[model samples]
Target: MIWHSTGRSEDGVMCHPVDGESWQKFDVDYPNFSSEPRNIRLGLAGDGFNPFGNMCNPHSTWSVVLTTYNLPPWLCMKESSFMLALLIPGPKAPGKDIDVFLRPLVEELKFLWQSGIRIKDTATNTFFMMKAMLLWTINDFPARSSLSGWSGQGYRACPTCNEDTPSYRAVNKVVYIGHRRFLDADDPLRMSFKFNGQPETRPTPRHFTNEDIQEQLGRLILRKPGKHPNTLKENMDRQGFELNRSKRSIFFELEYWSSLQLKHNIDLMHVEKNVGESLLGTSMMNDKSKDTSKAREDLKNLNIRRNQWLQKRVYQIEKENSPEFHKELSALSMGSQMDVYTYTACIINGVRFMVLSRDAQRKTQNSGVLTVCENGEKYYGQLEEIMEVQYPYDYSTVIFRCKWFDTGDIPDDNFISIDTEKEAYQDDQLIYASQAKQVFYIREPVNHRRNQNNNPRCVVEHVNHQNIWDLPSDNARVQNAYSDSVQDVDNVEVENVDIVQKDSSPGARLFIEFSHTFKAMLT
Candidate 1:
């Protein structure tokens, strides 16, 4: 069961003992052991006692050759177990290297297997149970002791040292400690700490400087545009809303105009034509009135007259005193006042005409003619006399006049004027008629008693002679019509007249006569 080295022989083979027997030149093979057998030869000699004689008497020498066998499994297993125990947990053995420890453990495992000891049975029955118990003690003891301080509170073990502590406080402490250590190692000015917590010198972390914090905060506050994918569509939609409002205004204006047209039933084309004609006429009148030669002559004549009157008045007033004259003159002098002139024109049918005029000097003649063409008929009058000027400056005006005549009587004239100036002119020409043929004088006032309360009454002068004709049923008539017929045509032939004959009875005769009279009056 034991292995002992005997000696090395001249043949250069190692001799060892096994099973308490000496082996020499023996073929020894052990599984997981030596691969070759070592051999040794022993010599013995016997001789008769020939005292002090290197005598010629000789004795025979004997060579003993022995064979050895492998040790038993039980014996080898026990030896291996003892070796493993000594290698693993024993004190440092003399003359043993790292290989010696490892090799013994390996040999023990192999011997245990050869002795029919299963590795799982040995681990569970003995070695593993003991190791597990030892590990449990080492892991649980510190954890149990630290529990009193950590009672009723959550705790996290330190990642580096595996010691129980409050998580955030532990992290902060470690960070500061690590920072201090790192600084002390690099900086000669900073004194390193011993077991005490106080620092002998100040230490700072360059990486955790104020500049780095500021840079990081600046990046957080000022973000790049379009970086967040989720916000891109929302931003785009907001921009689109702004764009749509501008585009929608045009559609709104169009709708407003259409509604206005529908409510007023205005013929836009007719309105435009009338406006153009009136503008043209006004321009013509302006050109004609701009003849400075006539205005200059009138101004000259007035100035001469005024100067003469002033000179005469001055001479008479001189009797009072020169001072009196000066005082009176100075009192009479007034500062210059700003004056403005505005002219407005409107078109009627194909003709252009002026509808309004405001002059600063109050000297400009207001008796300008306005010509209106309606339904292929021409009429002329002063705008001031015929229609009221509403907002003359804005050119918004209206004229109320009758559309048809019931009788031959002259209509009443209503005067409406908007005097915006500070001083009113009594001598201002109220109305003027151009193309005298189209002008008609109203000799009698119009009657409004029939529909006075119900209908709006307006007085319109007849611009056409044919419009003056009245039906026989109307009793009132102008008596001196022939005197004003100087411009009337004689024996004028008229078309579109119809005559009806009646029965020659008394009542029928009366009706026939009445009918004839009515026709004549209408004509």
Candidate 2:
């Protein structure tokens, strides 16, 4: 029980699974409301997924899911915990009619927010009044408008910065170019991109931010949607119920989550999918793939310029003179001429360690060692996995894929993410140490079967010892437990794991014997 201390009594905890410093921002930002552990923060997510494997069925399935950030790292992710708010079956996409489908869930949420329900915390074995509040809605670009009560297309598309989105007349239809307003006048991003070689004419009212249009407020009022400035007053004339009656979503009334600038964010994977598909459609010369997208005369000019740039980088200039070439050169570690890969230390079994990529050669194995949790070690458990993009890495990443070390700690903040994979702790995942301390990976597993149809992931087999005291302390100790050469499911060389000491002591040892256990605990 001493070694398994949950740190509930400690004042010095940071990234807590339930109520650590992770939720401090939301609480600190709002001084009017006192921070309490029982108040739940959550996010509503909805996506139209096809239940049928084949498109021949031709039906869309839209399901609303709510995730709670009130659970701990261990049990926060169990599928049984995920609250299925609603299920909307559709022969066609819900479009604007989606509000009718979301009413019941919203009403239930309204009741829960106003009058909390009695709930028991199994982890601490206590009963409490559990009041929940919606944080924001999560969805892909297509589903953003449907769930968040906002238009996702055209100039009025941006949920946070309404109508400030710059636009240019493309053909006959008005096409919104990009978020020209999101950039500063002198920002490098302002020059990074341009529409048809012309810099976007900056948005009017030059010094404006998302706070101008979107705000978290107490009242959710019905209004005619779109770019009109006087939308609230316009709703007075239009009096009806259901979809026709109100264009504004019931979500605006939550009162707690009203402050977020962008409530509805399109999933990045969908953006990547669109880009990849478009690039694929553009790459091939054959006519068979011609239907992938409409042919555009403008694309020809774009391709011509891209080709010219590629040629200049490849042939026209010396490699020493190119900035991009120099960047690649800088990627190589000093003396280790081969490219450098990075390793971010992840806390595993309360010990700070990192799994190097399988492709890491002995020479470049220790190339770019980034030791987090070395001094300021972040807590790891079923929760706290992050996937980020880094240079020079195709599959290189840090997986927070480790176990809950029942170190003496308890989160004082009632913050946990319920949107987690059940087997998150079991598999190897890449992660970044972010302040969020969110329980689940933002995306799916690295090698999920659905993601890579050709190469199905082999089921991972883990050897669970009865107690942490019995777990391996050294490579030899680990090899003793496994019959078939201490290998992961992927059959990589995991035997070379290096468990460096996290203690800041000038000369500390790895896994010191229990001889000093009593003294250490007393200290």
Best-fitting candidate, measured by lDDT?
2
Q: Model 2 residue 30 lDDT?
A: 59
Q: What is the lDDT of residue 122 in candidate 1?
A: 40
lDDT of 1 by residue, 1-523 (tens): 1232332334654432232222321213222223222111111111113333544644322111111223333442242432112212212211112223334433533343234232233423532111000000011212222211111222332222212221322311321133343354556323422212234343333333335323333332222222366655544332321211111111112211112111111224455766676677555656523224443344233232222234345656777666557532322221111221112322222122333332122344322332334543333333332222212122212121211222222223443121122222233323211221232322233356654433333233433333232222422221122221111112222111111111222222111111011111111
TM-scores of all predicted structures: 0.13, 0.44
Candidate 2 regions exceeding 4 Å error are 1-25, 29-34, 72-80, 123-125, 171-174, 179-184, 187-195, 200-246, 284-296, 299-523
- Error in Å for residue 161 of model 2: 3.4
Instruction: Give the runs in model 1 whose Cα sits over 4 Å from its true position.
Output: 1-224, 227-234, 239-370, 373-382, 385-438, 441-523
Model 2 lDDT per residue over 391-473, tens place: 23122222233334222332434332222223332433333332213222123245454564233222221223232322355
Task: Pick the TM-score winner.
Answer: 2
Full-model lDDT, candidate 1: 0.26
